[model samples]
Target: MSDIQLPEDDEEQQLYERETENTPETPLIRRSQSHESIISTLSAPPAYELYPPATTWSGRLLNFFRRIPTRFTQSSIALPTLSDDRADERSISSRFRIPQLELHPRIARWRYPIVGLCVLCITIFSFLLFCSIFFSPASLPSPSVPDKIANDTAKFLTLNIFMRPPGVKNNWSDYKDDRTDFIIRHVLPNYDVVSFQESFGFGSRRKDHLIRAAREMGYNHHVESGRKYPWQIAVDGGLLVLSRFPIKDSRLIEYPRGRHSDWMARKGAIYAQIECKPNSLVHLYTTHAQASYQQITSLWDDDVRTRMNQFSWLHSLIAETSGKDGSAVVLNGDLNVDAAVHKEKSSPTEPSEESSEEYEFMKAVLSGEGKKINGKVEYEDSWKIDLKDAVYESYGFHPVTFGDVKVDEYGMVVPAETVLTDADELMAVQSIDHVLWSPRQSNMNIEGVRVEKFMVADTHLDNDEDEEKGYTQVSDHYGISYVLRL
Candidate 1:
């Protein structure tokens, strides 16, 4: 305890310090401190452990194998770990581990349904297109033979004849000779039976000319009954039927006189019976009744009324005499009375007092009012019937009048405009020329009949003319022809 003097010598002091240092700790506190220092150094956490695991090598390896199906499954499967920190992080990582979808599965499930839907739509459209092509109304087939036959049978016979001798001037002598020549060269040569109106002859030799002409033309069976004027200036006059067939009977029927103080005389119609075939008879009538002009309307009315009476009478006669015998009746000629008057409802241009009378007469005739003769006789206006069906069919026969003729071409008789003014006038003028027959007689084969506007060439007349100036012909009316096959 005496002053624990320290050695001063350096080497001898170091040896002495080692010896003292190597001795067991003298204090309990110092021994504990030494133990604590050793333990702290040995138990200290590594810097690498503070951070996340070094997954570079494992991650690379896992990604490499993930492309394969089996490896991908194994890699996606969560593995259980022992580290508390790693376990906590695993929970979070698992939340984000989204499952990869298989490309083949998606395509396989969706492809067929989409394709089927498209195929169904295409099939439906194709079926509709096929049906439209084959079964549409516009694609219907042609008419059958039976339909054609029926249509043909319903048709009418129409004929147009021109009887003007060529190279004849507009003189009376020339006119007479030309007419005679026409009867011989054109009428007799071409037709077995003939009906003519406006058979005007020139000079003082009227009767002689007509008789001679008729005889020469082989028309031994003839009827000539019409208004005869003193100076041969007869108006609203006509001729009758002259045929090669056997003549059975004949008569003249007169028309009514209207309120015309200035008219010269009443008009008339001629009816006759001709043996057209073996043991068969046909009624034939001809007339030149009235003109449609306002100045002559009263006269026309008178003439039309009378003609209607005659028509009715003739029908009765045929029904009584021939209809029972199965004989057909044909009323042919220029009645001057139109079968249908389309303008009955309209007012006339430059109308006069007599215009109304004429309209009434026309309306009466067309409406079948004045057609009665003896209270029981009935005659169907064949022209009207044929016209009604004209829109659907070409019945072949139209009357010879101003309405049926065209200026650009030479018609059988005259330009249609000269006669027809409107629809009413067209109906009236169209059937003015006709050859009506009993449906039961003449073999009644409508299909075999042909109606045509006799061409001007056939009548030995020039048809071509200047379009602006109209036709250059002789007559004011056209000639209608009917060809009936018995």
Candidate 2:
């Protein structure tokens, strides 16, 4: 061993042994101890096969094409061995295996419940649609026309029809075609002239339907206010006048100022000269003034200020056009000005009070009291002429035309607010809708032309059976109608 002179390290020793000993050089590739050939390395799984296949076929195919270079490089390492029995099967399975989704246990458990919920929603929607189409309310039978009245007598009505646009939510109800149709068929035929405020939703299906129905019912002549400005987004003023009589001339005068959302629509009055009979012309004016909300308690609210401005403008219009040529002036509208609001006492220190300054001012302005526009034209609230005494004696004052009342499920008239109990309490709320007229001459006003028929229309729901308990009006305000004997 010492003479062998081993090299400094194992490298020199291996070199000496290989050179000195008679041996054959090993081949570049050799078999492993387990007899597995080096070529088996090429049969290993491709790069993409390490992860599970994508759920979608398109995704799987995309992965296949995207990893082609990686597969090619891996396969190029060595050729497949002919000795391997499952080589082709392994290759085909790895490249084209179908995906298997692996959903969590919790998600799979709730799948049926989610599907059932979707089905339930779809069923409810279909049922609502079916009810809306088939079970709709039909129009009531038309009432017979009244017998021909004296040539000098004329009938007029004012109503806030509540034909607001769709999608708006209110305290009473949504817009109903049956109510509108009922008014057109039954209410309008009984009167010579009708003025409607809040007859909004111009060009909508509801408005168009009402117009068509009115025309069919012999209300051929009509007039409405125009837009306040050309570039406005809101519809035209919500005032509409439908008359069986012939209209000689008509015009709309929009107020220069509006408050709150009232500015969106052109709020104004419709002035029409309607011939009630042969050579008997009546100057008719219909308007919808600024609206004050339920929360308002002060007389100096913005809505009040806006209404005062409109009132002044209205006075000017009547003074300029009405009471001329001996034509009778009739003013009809939802004034939104209550005659009085009775506030109940809260404690011993507090006392009940009634506020009515707005109502007083409105009367003064219309009657030419200190206002320059009222020099020639003077007006009087028609309800106060003759019916006031009877109304006062029975109910203490004129009943409210506007109140928080609605029909319950059982079709009973009930107060919407919890503070009130009986529907009669509504009479104490306040009176806003009215009919005011000035005499053909102040001398002949009270003597000749009285409110012959001072009646309230639509005081009960159309199909209500209990008149005493179910005295619900279709609109938010009651319809006021009267007969004028000239």
Candidate 3:
């Protein structure tokens, strides 16, 4: 390149300076000052030449508004102030356009990651909401009935169905919906009277399904133990009594004492006077007593005392109601009192003093042996009657109604494949489930009562096959049934 030479005259020097300031290498301050000097050279004009008065009122009002300053014009980006002589033939947008804002470098770098995190959070929340709606009991469909129905004339059944509330650790019965389906289709149709314990749930949940199913299967009469508030004491005494026979009267009596979590349950007895025949009435009582919780042999513990108190209360209720009428009275439920001389949890060989006392006291109360009543009547345990017969000796020890399968610490029943000892079998068969009956003493219309059949019916879910892969029980306690001849 050739060396640059300085301009000699004043006009030539001024023109050279302007050209130098317009170059790309020159700073923006020099260029801005040059534009300001050019604008200052324009001559001042008359008000009519600057802005002519509008011909119409509306046009004049619009012209007035155009003169007012706006936020956009007041911003840091200075817009050119054009006079009439300098105004160009350009659109309003081109004349005054706002520049786009640029994000900071740090914020722009994390844009994609932030968007991805937000999407993931929304997806997880949607999935949780779907699961809560889909798995709820209210959303479940009714169970289908089998074509082969098993209906008997007169039979009695009692079981603890173990229907706990959902979302709890203790709601451990696997395939709970399937188990309930089996009961409605196969079991309820065969029995004349059915009583269930531990049917716990809220609103139209598991228990409501059974109620609707039973009513459809001709079990029209039903009674549930009343509910209690949290402040009053506990929830409902989870008892549901169903009968094909017409029920004349019904009452529930909750025990005053309890132990552990049993204190939070409405554990009690339910009494129902049902018409077995057109003119023949039967007094039915169902109850669920205090749980042992692996401490069955402790006679001096709070569990034992609470149980004793419940028994006494039950005895008084029976004496006051059916004892005076001399009607056919039948008591069936989970009493939590084993008939065995010794319990499995205690010394295997040594006799349990608690068991002996419980058995004797239970028998005395049922038979009205010591308590003075208006009409003294005797009641017999149906299992004892059936086992005492010489012909029925091959029937073996009493059928194991509960604990054949163990429940883990979280209240889930162990699998059927879990091997149990001989002592376990011996103890389980002598469980607390029982049925006691007393024929009417003064009524000639009623006949003598005899247990034609006694069985611990399997309440397991069947798949309609002879040999199955594994056994799945409906509840911890088996359903005990009695086919009676009256």
Candidate 4:
């Protein structure tokens, strides 16, 4: 291979030699030479040219904005200055075209992983959203009506007014007004036979207020639960059976005993034989059994056990009172058993058996078979009723929530003056409140009597303290109604 070489020019070689040779020159001579170089460059004509004035008035107006200098950090682009001769190659006034960027190898290596992670996140979110829509426990639809009867209907209503615990309702006679209003507006006009739990008053005022409301509302006949002296007690144990018809031979029976907190009240049963028509007579038994009070750690807790006893007692009372009278018999009240479904987490202190955990009293009521304390009630659930009104149907029933309340066109909150929907309406399960009728398959003539319509009032107001929060109802539990074709 030959070594490559280039010919050297004489003038360039001579200048390099002169610069390499060190000269002891004075400061004044160096200064004069620097000044002369600056003068020569400044005197030269400019190579680049500014763009011509914009032709359109709008474009010319932009010249005012161009005077403002942009800081380096703010400027996103840099442009190259072209020489005067190169200006003919391209127009400076034309728009700057975007160029493709050459990404660094390090950044390009991470691009695929980032895209994969984003897709994975989106997929997971979509799957969760899909599951929420289809599988959420809330918003479960109520069960369809078992058998809508084609017979004539006799309306019956039963409600737990939450009228007791007068101390709780001491605020401006809160529940008192609600009870009166509901009876007059909703009950009197609609229901034929009405039964109320906790209808008695506190202190010396037993039936004065409720009696007035009933009479004023046109419920002329009121039967006290079978007691020798109906008006003797202090709290009235607050159970009363009011009839639009003649209440014949009606009485009240107190449970043998109550458990835990229920001992405070003389809780018991109310039974009435009503003449629905000249020939049509129906026996109605109403009772508020000892409540389980709250969460039961053990199925064998005193509350559950006592409630069982009360159930048996109630069944016995109904059997003795009605006794194959051939007349239709109906039972109504808050049994406090989660009938359809209950899977409460058992307390560790009390190991829970599946049988013991859920109320066994419910088993007896549904199947109409249990301990022979009252010799078993042969009653069936009203075609497995469902449609809210069931406690434990929801995590907790809070009536006063700031839900999507109706609003005016001006965006003001339009408050409701009355109860719109009752408790448990959202849950399509019958956890507790019910209407038990003797199935009339045996009575061919009684085929005309059928349970027509069952509805639960949304009695729980959104705000318990604030009157404006929810529906104006006193009871935490909803009132139950039925259209019984007599």
Error of 4 at 314 (Å): 1.2
Measured by lDDT, the strongest candidate is 2
Question: Each prediction's Cα lDDT score?
Answer: 0.44, 0.59, 0.58, 0.51
**Each prediction's TM-score against the native?**
0.44, 0.55, 0.55, 0.48
Backbone clashes, candidate 4: 17
Which of candidates 1 and 2 reaches a greater TM-score? 2
Candidate 1 residue spans exceeding 4 A from truth: 1-180, 200-207, 226-237, 258-262, 295-324, 339-400, 403-431, 441-474
**Model 1 Cα lDDT, one tens digit per residue, 1-486:** 557765566556566566777655422223233434534543445433444554799765444433344332332333233343333232423543548544476664675566568879999888767645432222123222111112112212222222222232333223344334444544455655667664432123343355555555455666755434334333333354666566788877655542242144345666677665555555565655444443234333554555555555544444444444555555555544544334565332211122134333433443334434456434454333110212112343232344543435542333344311333444233445544444453464323333444333445543452223222232434554454445
The residue-by-residue lDDT of candidate 2 on 72-103, one tens digit each, is 34423344343334433334324433454444
RMSD of each: 35.6, 15.8, 16.2, 26.0
Residue 333 C-alpha lDDT in model 1 = 54
lDDT of 3 by residue, 111-190 (tens): 55665688799998886665444323333333343222223235778887766545432322344565577678767877
lDDT of 2: 0.59
Candidate 4: minimum summed lDDT over ten consecutive residues — where? Answer: 395-404
In Å, residue 397's CA in model 3 sits off its true spot by 5.2
Write candidate 4's Cα lDDT for 1-486 as tens digits.
Answer: 246444455555566557756753422223233434434543443322144667899777455334322121122232444453444344332333344455467865675566568879999888767645432222222222221222455667777665554454423444455555545544556666788776654432334555555555556677654322213332345677877676777777787657665665677888887776656667788787776545667555777777776776676666677665667667777666544333455221221123233444554643335433355433433223111222222223212211112346996544322243322232222335555666332231222222212122443323333344233433445566666665
Off by over 4 Å in 2: 1-150, 171-173, 227-231, 294-299, 341-355, 370-396, 404-428, 442-472
